[model samples]
Target: MLAVQHCNNSALHVDEGFSNQTQQVLGVAPVRCRENLNTTTNPTAAGLSMTLGIVSNIIALIILAKAYARLRKRSKATFLLFASSLVATDLAGHVIPGALVLRLYISGTAGGLCNQSDATCHFLGGSMVFFGLCPLFLGCVMAAERCMGVTRPLLHARMVCTAHTKIVLVMIWLLALSVALLPFFHLGTYIYQFPGTWCFINVLDNTSITDVIFVLLFSGLGLAALAVALVCNTISGVTLVIARLRKKKCHRRSAKSHDIEMVAQLVGIMVTSCICWSPLLIFGLMSVIRSYSGSMGDDLETYRTLMVMGVRLATWNQILDPWVYILLRRAVLKKIYRITTGRSDLKGSTFRRWEISSFQNSMKSVINRN
Candidate 1:
């Protein structure tokens, strides 16, 4: 989360230099148009989004930690740790960069709060990239872990020990950090976008090799991760369906429902993530390609609204991720619901007791449906 804001000064300086000339030539004030958009829509949307995101992410972290604590020794595995890491990253995203966005909403301009050389701008940009990419990379890792669990159960169990999980997590953060900090080191560049509410790598601003490389890394890696997640999830879902069909001949209904539910949940999560991110990924790639061919500037100016919309859509992914996890964990969610509604069995207990084997059983259930 700390690496997202490592923006370069080039785009910021250039945009500011051209602000007046651009308005005069185009007969439309670019900054004023953006300010109008922000004044009308940013406060309401940013307020709701940040408020909800912060609260939900905190709740998710608590619930997930509680669930992890309740798991019996037999249920403890690398997946729980990976899951916790993902949640923590999402929480940081909301707490750190999301807070900065709220501040920008209040300050109302990149000039005062996010000057080119401002530490606040750099921090926000770096954290945004770090948190955003952490999820994408971690999502891929989670898919691979699930795939191995389904296809090579024995090998997966033996290889993915606690130490290996920790190592993998450390590697993930290191890589995310390296990518996020590249702009600060001058390997690439970062800049505030048109609206001044956020900053990120200036992928659409130039045609340099550094820009293309970063753009490809950002969009390509994300798309690839989503693809892997989709494929792996589909394979696991099909395997579960086959198991269900085989068991149905023996008159087992319970496992059938569980299998169906698991498949639906996996498909739903993958689909939602794809829908939320696909537009930004597509437009980002298009921008890179067109910029390389010297045909991007006019198109970008013409479709600035669409580009901003893509960024807005991408922002929702981090917010929605934790909810997906919580919703999928039916038992945990039930416990939370009960507690919130004052109907919990252990009203004053510090921890809610859950069946230790539930999560383990959930993973192994596809193979143990009988």
Candidate 2:
């Protein structure tokens, strides 16, 4: 800890590197963090991350509120309701540590309190692992659900039992959390290194087998989630397309169309997940597995730097989440329109609705190709 002037008559122990140093506050010491590092060209990725986070939370909150109002009576499992939990966790994973880092960064890079000791780190660590896993696996589970719904409507409707859905969802979250923490409990901590943040724990400094294991384990997890999302999304798209073509002669076309809508949204969800995390996931595996895989160490620092950037980009998910809701779930945008306008915006011309629908379909097709 370093001593700097206080707003009051007294001076205080504060990390000065992150601060503008223009003024002081009473009894408040600025937390030191890595954000003091140069971000001149970066737009304070943390700041952008925060803005994205705020927007997403607002959108999600709006959607949930509207959904509660609209389907207030329906106890069925809707995407908005189920995905809300994931949204909450993602917000925490992205925001809590991000805020802390920004604070420390502005205070001064030299030193500051980080995680109130190791226990706190574990909490953040566990939170990151838990939340990160929940979204990806949930996407996969969701894809399976969509496939059943479109491919086997009767079975899908019957299988929509609350008990089963709840059980599967809970298990998914638990398994993801457990998988993330195995390395930590076995030996060390999971770490995070973005452009301006490093949560979980300090990295490579420990150099224990446990540390390396945790790194591989978490990275592997990220990669797995991305892969599952891609494969499931592709299959879901193809399956839905086939189902629609086969049922063209029946009056079930509209129903089939709705099924396709759901599938497209599900695919969009996974595509977004893949785009957000794939780069980091790929590089993370290489870094962790290099010892066993071939050599690429001639540019280790470059790769490390790339890993940092990739992880930062991965966080785009949190920021993009609100937009995702608006596009993928009708509930969110409807609410946004209603709240902002004194009247309903859904009463647009038939042409407008068709346009919106067409845009969504095109986006799904393109995202699927990616």
Candidate 3:
């Protein structure tokens, strides 16, 4: 994410100075208005991604509910908690919002998805603004928590609790909303840009101040949050490795094979985070700068295609999250598989008591499903 933000800044600074007066580029013009300031994307692609996201989110929700039920009264894994949360918010911010935009475009809603009312736009925009930073901040929090767990394991157990976690969550919500909502407050334009097929905070008002605020909220603050998370996470992962080596030197039992497996699962989760999110960090600033500076060409169309692809990548996190958690914790997979198969696995469980009881108990509710 740091790399992406740096790359975006490098591209923008090289092409156009920060002066807004010299930058009079147009925004997404999906109408017949040949005056300028327009762009377009395939509603088909948007719709398809939305469909996939919705399906994925639904699956994740089911798998998670069963897992939670099965794990009740057990020592729940923190990464599992983080993964569950991140997936939920990813759907809210990226996938579902994108779906709404595409729905409006297909329905030919003239003023975006606000029912052509400023009030609705404000509600929608504020909603989008409020939840917008969720995935980014959630990722960071997950990473930070993971790092602290590895670096300061004893502290992790003592410092964090349901109440403390809730407080932290409240703070994250307040902070993200405070930063993202700043634009709506200052611009007094909540649903700033609809552009027919996609929606974003419009930065192309008469003053172009909207553009700056949009850039700052989505790019500036989003990048900062991601950077902090990535640094903490990277440190945590490295420390895990170091700790393992020291444990080996001391001839103390390192992380058990199962524990190592769990870390591997979390690593996959983190890698997907980078894949889905980094592109958005890089392209968001570049796209805005290009829009501001009139630097886009036919090749720029290709870039826009990639940008949309990147945004979709973030959306995929919602769907992929279920699998990540299931892979980390077997109970989730057991429940999902039982739900699909309609019967518990009778194939032959030669496993030990703890594993068998956990899987069977998890599958009990699942097997009873329709």
Candidate 4:
């Protein structure tokens, strides 16, 4: 009789376990796991997107390497090092997480992994945060470095070098990794996001003080970095303009032109990062606020849809970032200008020399003033 009772209890527990899994699969589980139940229904789209990202970043890396080879003897080598690191990080961002998602889709277990493997889910979630935030941080760093170079040439020359820049890059990666690892310490949670192809920090609802803090930290740092880049870039740009107005010579214009080119790239980085990352960071904060205020009443689905859209938008930053360096340089812009205006003579024209020389003189004036 006891044996029969034990068998019945075992059967009952098995049924309960199956029921819980079913609920989770159907999006009827707790709010934490209630993302859209559709799991990589369109593998083609996932595959194509990852392929394009991987290819573009690879091309960008190649271009950067060639440029670095040419610029190794130039003063801009430090800046190129930072740019190369950012591209490498973005490449890893695409490869590591992209490979995992592709594996899940290929194995026909896209949605089931989160339910079956906690470690896999956590790593995916952390990658999402780490990659998302690293570019923004690096953008700020690049902008600040350029700003100092333009506005305080003496101080910049004394302090910024390739070795120091490398140390800074390592520190930036460590900082991002530290934040990504917080969830493992019970400071936050990572769960499968909608369509069940990726995992990220849970932004749908608040469950603990640590979770709220983690979300705030991620979004807050991103927004703050953008803000700093904006200010530094603005000041650097204004200083350049002022220097240009103060100087009238054409000698050393190449140097000034190079400075302008670097600043221009920084501006491009700032704009791309703002457009790509703002929606997601803003949505994260809004979601938290709405959860706290009980205003998510009937718009939970809308919020989820927006979150997915935001994530998709953020991914574009990685792809767009490389192009900023590839296309915004002096050589490329001059070629494009010549093509559009049918002025091939612009390349070897006297005006081009004056333009370069004037830029160099203006830069000198600014440094002297500093």
Strongest candidate by lDDT: 4
After TM-score superposition, the amount by which residue 72's alpha carbon in candidate 2 deviates from its true location, in angstroms, is 6.5
Candidate 2 lDDT tens digits, 55-160:
6767776776666565432322444455665566666766665665556556543122332234444555566566666777777777667667656767876676
Model 4 lDDT per residue over 116-191, tens place: 3277778888988999889999999998999998899889888999889989999999999999999888888887
In TM-score terms, candidate 4 sits at 0.84
Candidate 4 off by > 4 Å: 1-35, 113-117, 248-255, 347-351, 354-370
How many clashes (backbone atoms < 3 Å, residues ≥3 apart in a chain or on different chains) does model 4 have?
8
Query: Which of the predicted structures, 3 or 4, would earn the higher TM-score when compared with the native?
Result: 4
Our model 1 lands, by Cα RMSD against the true structure, at 7.9
Whose lDDT is higher: candidate 1's or candidate 3's? 1
Give the per-residue lDDT of model 3 (tens digit) for 124-221: 55655555477667767877776776677679867866566667777877887776566556653443342323334543322255655566567666
How does each model score on lDDT? 0.64, 0.56, 0.55, 0.76
Q: Per-residue CA lDDT of candidate 1, range 1-370, in tens?
A: 2111212223344354477588679896444223312332235566677677777777778876776675523324455677678778877777777667666656755433232335666677688768767887777787777667766767987787777888988999998898888877776566665555566666555557887788788788788879998888888777766665876587543232323334444455567678767887777777767777787756765444555667677778777877887787656556687778777575443223223223446667556654
The alpha-carbon lDDT assigned to residue 96 of candidate 1 equals: 78
lDDT preference between candidates 1 and 2, better one:
1
